[model samples]
Target chain A: MRRILPWLTPLVLGALFLASGQQEVIIKVMGGAQKPALAVPDFRGGGDAAQHTGVFNETLYTDLDESGLFTMVAKSMFPLAVPQRPEDFRAPLPPPPRRKDAQPQRQGPWLTDWSAPPANASHLAFGYLAVQNEQLVLFGWLFDVTQQDVSNAQLFGKRYFGPLSADGARKVAHEFASDIIVQFGGAPLTASKIYFISDRTGFKEVWSMNPDGSEQKQLTNYRSICTTPAVSADGTRLAFTTYARVNPMIFIHSLETGRRLPFYNQVASMNATPAFTPDGRQVLYASTASGYAQIYIANADGSGVRRLSNVRAIEVEPKVSPKGGEVVFVSGRSGPQQIYKMNLDGANVERLTTGEGEASNPAWHPSGEVIAFAWTRGFEPGNWNLFLMDVASRRVDQLTHGAGRNENPSWAPDGRHLAFSSNRSGSSQIWTMLADGTKLRRLTSQGRNEKPVWGK
Target chain B: MLTKKYVAALLLSFAILFAAGCKKKAPAPPPPPPPPPAEAPAPKPNPPMITLFAAEPGTIERGQSSTLKWAVEGADDITIEPGIGRVSANGSRQVFPSSTTTYTLIARGPGGEARRTATVNVTAPPPPPPPPAPKATFEERLAREVQDAFFDYDKSNIRDDARATLTRNADALKAIFRDFPDRSVSVEGHCDERGSAEYNLGLGDRRATSAKEFLVQLGVPADKLRTISYGKERPQCTESNESCWQRNRRAHFAPGQ
Candidate 1:
């Protein structure tokens, strides 16, 4: 069982990483059931590179901490001999046979200091940052400190180079952190983005920011009401509803080209809440073309428009399943808005939510096994909170307590996290948290923000 | 006869001599020219003359104000009607009119009395209809007589009061359909701020449908009615209270395109 245990941890981790559908990796690890305790020491080497190293160390620490897959050892508990390279990592000498009247020796800390006591870390990540040849040079290493064989303790080594600036340091740090995470059989969170609507500039425009809320940038300057931003599966395009014209219409913009794409404006008083299919070949949205709001599917370029819901009720916020054949949407056919699942051709039409209050804004996890949505369940009364429902069993779980209106849950690409908007902080703003409803971090503070959609 | 002939010849000679003498008197001076035609009596002093008498804005929307301007000359008293009793000879007055009205300016003086009329054309009535008037249009009547059906929080079922309201709406709609069979009315559902914006759209839709179905059961033509949901986007009230929320949750009617 001990032999199997050592291999089982890596196998399970690799399986989870594969199940997440992240970029394929060739590395693996052998460990136990407990979360691998990791210690990230401030990188050595400082001069003109002090500020850059500070940025790198801070960003690296945040990335690893937010991953939720590691137990970070506190800095105060770190050993004195923080390694900067493979040569710096050394094996401790055996203690003297019989220490008679011999004072305890004062020596550099060894792996025992890290593997024992308050710094009980199973793994260690340390690196060096320096300005070399007018560039920021970084060397990062991850070691399994619990390994008895000193040579086997080293897991991997990597080197990265960038411009000698804070942004460059951040880039290097993220890259190194991604490598360390991939080595541990997990998806990296540094590259994923959250798209949302913000009225900070006096107009609701499409804005995007890193999941950590850094580098918030406006993508559309329509000078009109814009909302419900959805990014394509490949993250190359964005679709949203804009009131640039007299009536609301769906507009698709190419994120790669920074230009608007052609979309046929449906002949309706309102066309809103657009979503993209997993294949990025078709777009789904709700339009009032037939005098009522119904789900409509069209080509990505807005051609071949076809209605997917035939009921004489409001069917809106149509989100296609990540597997690409089914769609879950909010409908009023049963009197109040409830989440329903249906086939691509508008058949099957199975209701997924029931009981008091309304369910809305259903978002599919990349795995397609669960959906995250907002529901005003009876217990909470008029307050809206996010919930997760298993697609097959219909088992429901509430993710957020009734604090203020918390809604618009969008699953991150890793499927373990979500980005949503909440008024818990006194005003509507974009916030992100783990899928299990922990580590809530506010993403936007300027003006009101809502309808966050995470992707890539 | 001979004596008579001699005497007649002498007389003829005298007569010829007198004719010759008359011709010689010539042009005894042409009689004095007739006196120049007499001048007509001097004109009376300038009577009440209105050089400019007008409403600065001849047309205005209901409840809007417009100014009545006038410039009068040669009159001791200048008065305007239809609200303004009297005014200076040259002055302007801002007038707030409830409906279209014509103001007449009467200038009276020693010379004469002059009158001028300026009409202010008022447009459509304000949104809130005053007590029903005889001239109200079918559209206006429908807006006035039809009461919006209200709903409870997060519920779309017809409430007791909403049932009564829908019944009256059904009757009004039936009348409208009878008069204008081609016209259609839209039932716009609205919700309060107690719900998510997206879900409220569906909740509002259900409310509108509830109202529409009730009207259909009440014998109102289902074809003449359509439904739409504004959700919480178009709230009737913004205050955060039960009264304001109740006011916001309703199935409103609008004339269809």
Candidate 2:
């Protein structure tokens, strides 16, 4: 019996270890239990090549870090020497023999050599930038270190060649980061252009910029108030509200042809907040053509406009779900402004937010799991902050802590990040952050920027 | 048979009574001369007056001008309504009324206020229908005849005050059509910046169409009026107050071909 007991104990310990290991594997496969730790080392370059290297490395790191799907390992915690080439990466070495009388030490680098896997990093992204023929070329690679077999290391690799300009540097980094995201079976943020309203040119006009806030170009020179920009699904046409004469009118500008025309120039009513359906066949917007603000669905060319919402309150800022099955909008039917959801046919009306100062600009996450909106608890000016509510559970989570008025939360196409307008820096500007409300980054610095809408 | 002392007392009482009667009969010392009749108070002047209020020529052509003259007495302030603002107590103003309009002059004084009105009649003689001019130089004249129609806050329905203005506008439009059959009028809708720009666009459209419909109902050809909505984009007044917004929320008329 004693002899059998010793054997049974070892068997029990072995089974327990195998069970825990399997559980971890299952969690990793699901990719929902905990964020995967990612290590982004500085890209290798020297001299003139280093000009874009720093920006490229930082932008890639920021892009992944703000994805909300990764926990970025700090650069300080990396090895003393980073290996930028894929061939330079090596697996951790075996631990040395320990004496019974001595205390046990850590298994890797701290105890032995520096050739070891990073601590708690399941993924590693490393790259190098070089100036080749007057162009900045980026060669990036991502590795999944979670596997025990180091021989099967390559997850994805990308090569980007562009002009040696600042915008080129950001684009290279963004493109490589998008490749890495796609490798993980996630939707890439397709909205490379963010259309916003800026008052930099003396009057509020429609302005657009790269997602990284570079190459900002004014799209309209109306010299009057222009706002509420809506980009078509194909990113070809931009529809916005402009005051060309004495009243606001919806005007569409073709990005390719550079021609502008009025979509609806009815003389007495207001039409604003236009959103194209996923199929790009129709545009849903808010209009007061019926004597009160109501949601209206119209053809792409402003024909066949019909009311979509029947409630006798101000219904504006309509956003159709990614699947085009439902819509969420801002309504004042219950007195104070609140966000509500309804079927695409305007049936099964349900209020999504209640008991607040005011809530507006409800943005549907691309995953269709959550909705983010701007909420204020009181009537105080600059009290608006962002809040995300789970569509099914109705659990509300505040995303901003009143740094300044944070309103107009727009979800990144990835469904893991958001771009919003905040006056936190004294003047309203466009800002971006992860979906979990971390890593706040300012995207605009000039002029008063508001109503940032990320294009699909 | 009475005693001698009693007879003497009775005779003395008789003599006293006879003396009192003689005094009474003598007119009681001529009583006191009658007092003079009470004098009446002098009369007070009437309150400040507007002695004269007149509009010279009284009646003129639709585009012709007239002078408004007024005289006021004992006034600290005076004003004339219908766009002739504050003025001196005794003054004259030359006014051009597109339609028959009554200008009221109000003179305020310490005693009270006196008001007088002078109406200038604008007459458009019905003429034999004229032939259409393809390249006429009446563009500016036609532009002046098309009047703006106003609306209330967040409302597209024409107000009661706007009806009179619209009637005049309709009459002028009818006359224009009778002479120039090819010209058309465009009614532009506008709104105050009190609501969302998109919603205001719809509201402005309704307002422009409402004005156009009214003109059509008043005998103007339906095809003569075209509608466009500006939706609070072009505010007549840039101020953020209600007064400015009221002016912005209107339907403006522009002569179109």
Q: Choose the strongest candidate by lDDT.
A: 1
Residue-by-residue lDDT tens digits, candidate 1, A5-33: 99999999988965762211101111233
**TM-score of candidate 1 versus the correct structure, residues matched by position:** 0.67
DockQ of each model against the real complex? 0.17, 0.12
Worst 10 residues of 1 chain A by lDDT: A22-31
* Best DockQ among the predictions, by candidate number: 1
lDDT of 2 by residue, A1-456 (tens): 998999999899988976664333212222465666777878876556687777777778777766667778777667765666666655554555664555444333221122244456777887788888888888887877665554566687778887787778888888888888777766666346788999898899988887667778988899988877877767788888766664455788888787984465433346677888877778888776665668888888888887788976667888888778888888767865678888888888889887567677788776676788888765452267888887776767777887987887887666667789888898889998876677788989888898888875
Task: Give the best candidate by TM-score.
Answer: 1
Report clashes for each candidate as comma-separated counts: 0, 34
User: What's model 2's lDDT at B64?
Assistant: 88
Name every residue pair that clashes in candidate 1: none
- Per residue, candidate 1 scores C-alpha lDDT tens digits across B139-231 of 897889888888998778899999888888888889888878888888888999877676666567668878888999999888888776677
Task: Go through the candidates in order and give each one's C-alpha lDDT.
Answer: 0.83, 0.76
